[model samples]
Target: MKVRNDAYLKAFGENLKQLMAKSNKNAETVAALGGIETKQVYRVINGEHSATLSIVYAIAKGLEVHPKELFDFTFQE
Candidate 1:
């Protein structure tokens, strides 16, 4: 369970990073648009913590992308 959770977080984090890069918005701008703190953005992007679905949606919305984009992770066993 722990291993799966770790893998999930890593993949989610990577997805967030890619979206942010594609967004062309700096962390602070994205956080402000998402109505979250910059630190929270870093936390999610750095894989220091997992985010709730609400948070994921907010981030995707801020990035001007579909929420599904955030969940487009590679499958793992």
Candidate 2:
């Protein structure tokens, strides 16, 4: 299925990518830590889907950062 793209999603995805790079981590690793499927991580990273609150917390845990960090990006909506 094709997921819709929005400014919020795009910003979140970009931040996720940046965090992944800075942490020297991959989708597989994050997924394992977050207890989610690798594809899910990719979906968020690719800006193809929006993550739920739980997923956001999980991703934050995987990234070893606070949940607020993930949302520390500019968005208009």
- Score candidate 2 by lDDT: 0.88
Candidate 1 — which residues are off by over 4 angstroms?
none
Please report the candidate that would top lDDT against the real structure: 2
Superposed on all Cα atoms, model 2 deviates from the true structure by an RMSD in Å of 3.4
In order, candidate lDDTs are 0.83, 0.88
The whole-model C-alpha lDDT of candidate 1 against the native structure comes to 0.83
Candidate 2, clashing residue pairs?
none
lDDT of 2 at 72: 88
Candidate 2 lDDT tens digits, 1-77: 22334777888999999999999999999989989888989999988878999989889889899999998888666
Each candidate's TM vs. the true structure? 0.88, 0.86
Query: Which 10 successive residues of model 2 have the least lDDT summed?
Result: 1-10
RMSD of each: 1.3, 3.4
